[model samples]
Structures are given as C-alpha cells and as structure tokens.
Target: MLEISIKPEVLGYIGAFPLTNAQLTSWLSSLLLIVVAIVVGVNYKKLPSGLQSIIEMVYEFFQSMAEDAMGAFGRRFVPLAMTFFLFIVVSNWLGVVPGVGSLVSIHDPAKAVSAGIIPFGAPAVMAEAPPSADATVEEQHAYVPVFRGGNADLNTTLALAIIAQVIIHAMGIRTAGLAHHLAHFKNPLEIVTELSKILTFGFRLFGNVFAGEVLLTVMGSLVVVLTGKLAPALPFGLVGGAIAIPFVMLELFVGAIQALVFAMLVLSFLSLFVKTDQSASHH
Candidate 1:
C-alpha cells in the first residue's frame, strides 16, 4: 500500500509540543551539521587544502557576495545567509537518504484512519468514509513512515520565509528609514505585496520538495506494481528498488538548486536595498 501525506503527521508529543515527522528530520539535519562543524572546526587549519580548500573557496564566494551586497551590513548577513543555505541544503538532501522514508510504524488501520494518520479508500487515492470497527483483517494494519523531508512541510518553509522577511523588512527600515518603511502600510496593496513575499518564499520551497517526495513515492510504487508478477513470492509492491535511482539523483540535484536559489534570492533582495541606500546617500 502507498501512503502520501501532504501535511506532516504528528508522531507524538513532548510536554506541550507537537512533534511532526518533518520537524524531527529538520532537527536531525541541524544536529548532523552541528556535529560535522564541530569536527571540522577542531581540525580546521588557517591554510586551506584539498576538501578544506574547496569549502573555504565556497564560503569566500558567499561571504564576498554578502559583503558586496550589504556593504556595512554584509559581514552580519554572512552568518544568516550561510546558515540558511547549509540547513536547507542538508534538509533537502536528507529526504533521499535511505531509511528516512522506508521505516514505518505499525498501527491499527481503524485507529490510523480515525486519527487522520492514514486516509480513506483502498490504497487511498480517493477520499471516502472511515472504516467501521468490524473492518476487514487486511484493512486493520497501517505502515506510517516516521521521517519525512523537512522542507516538504508548509510550516517549516513558512517559518524560514517569515525569518527571511523579518530581515528583509528590517533592511528596508534601516536603509530607507522608519518613516519610509512604515509608509508601506499606508497602501493596502503595499501591505499585500509585503505579505506576498513571505508566501512566495514559503510556497516555492514547499511545493518543490513536496512534489519531489510525491513523485518518488508514486514512481517507486508503480515500479513495484509492474514487477510484482515476475517475482510473485516477494511482497506485492515491495521488490523493485533499483528503478528509483535516477529519480533520487534528480531529487538531489533539485535539492541543491533549490537551496542555492533560495540563498541567491535573499542576497538579491538585500542587494537592491543596499543599492537604493547608496544611491540615496550619494544624492
């Protein structure tokens, strides 16, 4: 059976907090990056060579861009822009990692359907009513994966967008002054424009990652179904794993592009403000 969830499913709770699979993956991504950074920093030398040299060059590229874009604020901007790029890149790539989507939690289907953890209908393409208490034995079980792509969840992407927008509008205030920044609220359309940037940021990442996830899931499912007849002893829709390789590679590429696109867009927006300020200062 294939399960596709557009929304991140809440797996459990910690005190008052609701823990979703997307959030879990995001935390794992952050932790992994932190550990790697610690290891690298401890061994880090002033002079670069090999992979270290390559990494330093990449950092210099972004650091230089940020400095050029924001001028005085660029140094401050480097940390944030770099963090967003690294975190997003890792989160996107982690989606295609083995076992992230394969590990499943067993649940009673009636309970799963009732809780909205699993949807209605057979193999569940179409929505229907929940199964009754006395449902078929086959329908009594559900396999819910415990991990998902961090950016695939709207909440995660929207939160990142919200943070970026804060910096963007703050830059507007600083470069143009409070009077000019507040003037944006005078026009309802301007207010909407401001709001739209956040939505655009959030939805763009979420749509790409979520669509990729669905594509991989459906593709794997289709491959398994087609091959089931040839390997009848193997569980239906469980034997074909090799067919998804190209797609996994494609997703990895897409993930990197998305991360770079997001970082560049933020840098571009900041640069526009810096240019405006510089022009105003000259006049």
Candidate 2:
C-alpha cells in the first residue's frame, strides 16, 4: 500500500536529536555537491574538457543570468544562487528514482490505517501484527526511508526561505543603512508582507515536490493493484513501472524548473532591495 506522509518520518535518533529521512537526504545531497566541488577544484585546467567543460558551462550560464538580473551586484550573489539551484534540482530529481520511497514500513499499523496512510488490509502483510486487546502497542515502529527528496519536506523549504530572506535583509541593511531598511517596515502591512514570504516560499516548493512524490507512489500502486487483479501470476507493478517512465522524465524537467525558479526569485528579491538602496542613496 502507498503511504503519503506530510511530515518526514523519524528514522532514528542521534543522542537527544531525532534524525529524519528528509534530513538524511539533505545531508547526502550536500555531500554530493561537496564531492563534486572538490573534484572540479582539483582537476581545473586552463582548457576545460569533459566534466570540467560542463561545469564551466553551468557556472557561466548562472553567472550571466545573475549579472543580467542585478548588474554588478549580482556577481557577488552568483555562488549562493547557484548553490541553491544545483542542490535543489539534484535533490528533487533524486526523489523520482526507484527505491527512494519504497524502503518504508508501517510505523503504527492501527494509526496508519485509521489515518488512511495505509490500506486496512496492509496489516495482513506487515511484519508485525497489531497488539492484542490487552497488549500495549509500541509507541514507535520502524518507518524509515533510505532516501527522500529534501524539497518535499516543509522543514527544508522553510529553512531555505528563511535563510534567503535573512540574506536579503542583511544586504539591504548593508547597502542602505539599518535605519533606512527599517523605515520600509514602519508600515505594519509591509512587515506582514515580508513575514508572509516564509510561508509562500516554503509551501510553494514543498507542495510541488511533495505532490510529485505522492503522484508517483499512487501511480505505481495502481499499477501493482491492476496487474495483480488481471494476472495474478504476473510480476507485481512491472506494467506500472513501464508506464511511469514518461512521468519520471517529466519529474526531471519539473525538478530543474523548480530549482531555476527558486534561484531566480532569490535574485529578483535581492535586486529589489538593491534598487531600493540605490534610490535612497540618490537622496
């Protein structure tokens, strides 16, 4: 049965802190970026070739886009924008791969079934049956995923949004003085609007990525169900797997677009603040 969880399931704990599948995925994604950076840094050549050429092309593309967006000021932000774009796109696409969402088990059979996270009949095949009437069910069960997309989790998205907003505000203050930046917030509505961006940024990324994850899961599950009904001896979900190939490709495009959109929005917001600073300086 397919399970759609809004929150990333707690896989385990490291001392007092609980580790989530989303966090694990984020860490792995960051590690991947770091490894790539190190490899590119070590293998640099005046005349680029192969992976180096591709890397240079990507850097040049973002550099040009950033420069076009905010003039000279944008050059200083190229690294941050590119980091967000690359990490997010990689993480989003990773979620579309096989075995990411499959290595999950029921955390709480009764609760999951009650909450519609698992089918009522799922308990039959679950590793452990629910406790008997007099027995106590354990509070936690092993519901861990090997990998999950970082952008699909609200925490990851919200944190990114908060960080972007903080950088924007800091840049605004540095460019146009704290007093001048604060003056814009003198209007209570303006304050509210700025704060509301957290929700907007977080939900936009979370909703899109999460929806894609759920859609793939449901589609795959439907394939399994249909195949089982039509041909009981047929391999489970094989037909569904073939059908989902196109959707996987679509997800790859969507992931890249979402990353680009996020990076562009950050650049746009920075540009707005930069413009404000420029206007105030003229006064």
Candidate 3:
C-alpha cells in the first residue's frame, strides 16, 4: 500500500518557520553546490586539469548554447541559465538516490490523528495500530519520510518560476527603457500572457518531477508486495533490483532534459523581449 500525499511533510521547525522534508532536501542541494563551487575556485589553474577541465567544458558548452540563442547579449545571461540548469538537474537526480525515501520520522499517533494531518482513510501502516496494553499511551507510532526531491515540491518549483520571471522582466526593462517595456503591457492580452507564464513555468517542472516521484514510489511498493508473497525467505530489495534499475536510468535522463528545457526557455524569453526592444529602437 502506498501513502501518497500532495503536501510536503513537516519534519520540524526553525524558530517561527516550519521546515518541510522537501525544503530540507533543497537546503542540502544548495549546500552541496556551494561546496563544489568553493572547491573549484580554490583549485583554479592557468592550465585546466581534472575537475577544473570538466568545469571549463561544461561552462563553455552552456556559454556556446546561450550565444547561439541570443548572440552577444546572451553572454550576460549565461550565469543565470547555467545556475538553473545545474541546480535543477542535481536536485532531481538526488531524489533517486538510495535511502532518500526510506528514512522516516516517527510521531505520536494520537497527536498526529488529532491534528487532522492524516486523511480520514489512510493506510493503517502510516499511523500504526493502536497502542498495546503494555505500551505507553504517548508512544510515537506514525512514520513519515524524512526527505523528498526538491523539485517534487510545488513551493520550490513555483519559487524558481517566479525568480526566472522577475529576471526576465528586469532584463527587458534594462534593455528597453521602463516606459517602452510598460507600453507593451498596454494591451490587456499581453498582461494575461505574462501571468500565464507563471503557471506554465511552475507547473511544467512541478508536475513532471512530482509525477515521477509518485510513479517510482508506487512501482517499488508493488515490487515489494509481490516479492514478499511469492518468496517469504527472499529479500524484496534483491528481487526488485532488476525492475528498479531501468526507471532510475530513465529518471536521470528526464532530469537532465528538464533542466535543459527550462534554461533554454528562459534564454528564449529574454531574447524575445530584447529583440522586440531592438526593433522598436530602430523605428
């Protein structure tokens, strides 16, 4: 049985803020990026080798892609595009790593139930059976996963989308004067188009990542259940290994493609706005 919840589980708190499992994963991803950046900076070389060479190659690849998209102006936005691509691809891949979804946090069943966090009819395993006569009344029994993929959370994806849009608009204003940028919005439909970009950008990444996570969960659960019934002595983990490997590879490809798609779209939008301004200026 799978216990799938759309909302991210609350793991704990930081001062007045509630920290979610997805947010925790996002924090870890950011930390990982920071450490890698520091290492690359420290190991800089006049003649690139090893990690520095790899970093240089990746930078050149993205830089060339951006150049092809927006010519000279693209150089200014390469950092933004590269950041989005790297962060999102890493975050997506992290979700598929072993132990990420397995670790769980225990909570008091009575408190969890009273809080109305669990639905009216959820799997019994999610909250465990009622405490036995020998058990303490306040014993914690409910278990929730401690980590989830960052992009699987709507809040994270939406935040990324909002940031991208803000940068796009800012670039527009910088390339064209504020008055000219505002003039484009005089048509009411253009305002609607701008608003629609938020939903399009946010939901595209969120839906794909979230759906992939759910599918993997369901597949793993099914394999375990089937294996347990067929062979009581055999470990389900071993038996399910064959079935899980292909999906893992598929997810890796999907993650990279999604990252590239998002970065390219950002570049395209920026180019569109800039070109529009250029044409207006010549008139």
Candidate 4:
C-alpha cells in the first residue's frame, strides 16, 4: 500500500512543544550556529577562501545592517545582532530541507501500531512496511525522531525573544546606569510605555516567523493536493516545487531581517537611554 501521508502527524508532534514553530526553529538554529562557530574558528586563516568568503560576506552584511540601523557605534552591537541573524536564518531555512516532516517512522495500521517512548503513539501517517504480519507484537514501541526541523516549535522563538529582552535590558543598564534602567518601570506612566515595548517585541517576532511557517505549510499542502488537478495545465509538481523554492529563500532573508530588526530595535531603545544618561550627567 502507498505510505500513508505523515506530514500532518509529524507537524502535530512538533506542535506538542510549549512554544510555536518559530521558537523551536530558533533553538535548532542556535545549535546549528554553535556548530558553525566551531567550524569557522577551527578553519580560521589569514587569507579567506570559499567557505571563509561566505562567512566574510555574512559578517559584512551584518556590519552594514548594524551601521544602517544603529549608526557609527553600531559595531558595539554587531556580535549580538549577527548571531541572532545567522541563527534565525538557519532555523528558517532548515524547515525546507528534504524529508523534514514526511520521512519519519510511524505506526502501521494494517500491521500493528506501536507507542513511542514519549508516552504518545506515533502518528502512523507513513509506513515502511505494513508491520510483519507473521508475529505477535507489543502495544507500544520506541520510535526514533525521524522528521525534525528548527522553526517548527514556538519554544525556540520565545527563547530568542527572552534572550533579546535580557540583552537589551542589560545593555541599557550598562549604558544608562541601574537607576535609569529601572526608570522604565517607574510610575504608571512608564509602565504603559515599557509594557508596550515588551509586547511589540514579542508579538512582532512571533507573528512574522509563525506566519511564514504557516504560509509555507499551506502552500506545501496545496501543491500536494492540487498537483494532480493542475497537472495537465502545467508541470504542476515542478511548478509547485519552483514556487515553494522562492518562499524558502524568502524565509532565509526574512529570518535575517527579523533578527536584525529585533536587535536594532533593542539597540535603538538602549541608545535612547544613553542620550538621557549623558544629559543627566551634564546636570
């Protein structure tokens, strides 16, 4: 029999996390980043080569983004901003990798579905074999995590948000002093302002990244369902694949943009305090 469609079921597994897809993607992205850092460090050299050239371009891009957003002293925030950018981009791109949500081992209804170690039954969306028909089997079985992607979980994105807030506040305090930083919470007047900032940061990041994932999912589903219907008019599967390609590429760019936007907003907000501090110091 044809392998049962498993994409939705695998997606459901990813959804079981506390955070949304964007967050989960961020976590995977962070791991990918750590690995990349190690590789870059290990292969550092006086003259840049193929891989180094790409890394250098990334660095320059971040430098340019920072300069445009945070001005001359934007170099101060480049490390954080660049790191965030790379992580987000990688996380977003990982979602488009082959077999991310489909090629996982799952239950076989014709044979016997087995439970996974996670205490939940694996969604038998796809089956390698219809289970061995000849033998008795246990009710539950350990299934491996076959399909995985970075941006599929909300926890990862939220973690990035938390990190951004922490770094932003820390930088603000360092630049403007503890008293001034705490001033963000002073009085009901300030509460309204600060709360708005917090919500804006959280929701903007969440909405953009989550929306991208949803769009990709919907498009992918449409292609899967409609390719046959549209086959005669065009090379439906090929066209669908082509259409999906650009979105994944767009996600890569958007991820970097969102990260840069988040980081720059933090820097800009903190810099505003710097001006306040200097004015107060003069008095």
> TM-score, each model?
0.79, 0.82, 0.82, 0.64
Question: Could you tell me which 10 consecutive residues in candidate 2 have the lowest summed lDDT?
Answer: 118-127
Off by over 4 Å in 1: 71-73, 109-141, 183-187, 227-239, 274-283
**44-138 per-residue lDDT for model 2 (tens digits):** 89999888898788788888987887766678888988988988997998788787776555665675544333333343323343334544333
The lDDT ranking, best first, is: 3, 2, 1, 4
Report the number of the highest-lDDT candidate: 3
* lDDT, candidates in the order shown: 0.74, 0.76, 0.77, 0.58
Stretches of candidate 4 exceeding 4 Å from the true structure: 1-28, 64-74, 105-149, 184-187, 223-239, 274-283
What C-alpha lDDT, on a 0 to 100 scale, does residue 270 get in candidate 4? Answer: 54
* Cα error of candidate 3 at position 114, Å: 20
Give candidate 3 regions above 4 Å deviation. 108-141, 225-234, 275-283
Q: Give lDDT: candidate 4, residue 242.
A: 73
Q: Give candidate 4's whole-model lDDT.
A: 0.58
What tens-digit string does per-residue lDDT give for candidate 3 at 1-283? Answer: 4567777776654544557789999998999889988999998989999878987887887899878767766788889998999889889998888867666654655654443234334443333333355432333336667788999999999999999999999988888779978988888999899888988988999898888887777666566566444332346556565567788888888988998889889988887666543345545
Pairs with backbone N, CA or C atoms under 3 Å apart (clashes), candidate 1: none
Model 1 per-residue lDDT tens digits across residues 43-135: 788886665676677688788987677655566677777788889989999998987876545455565544334333355322122345343
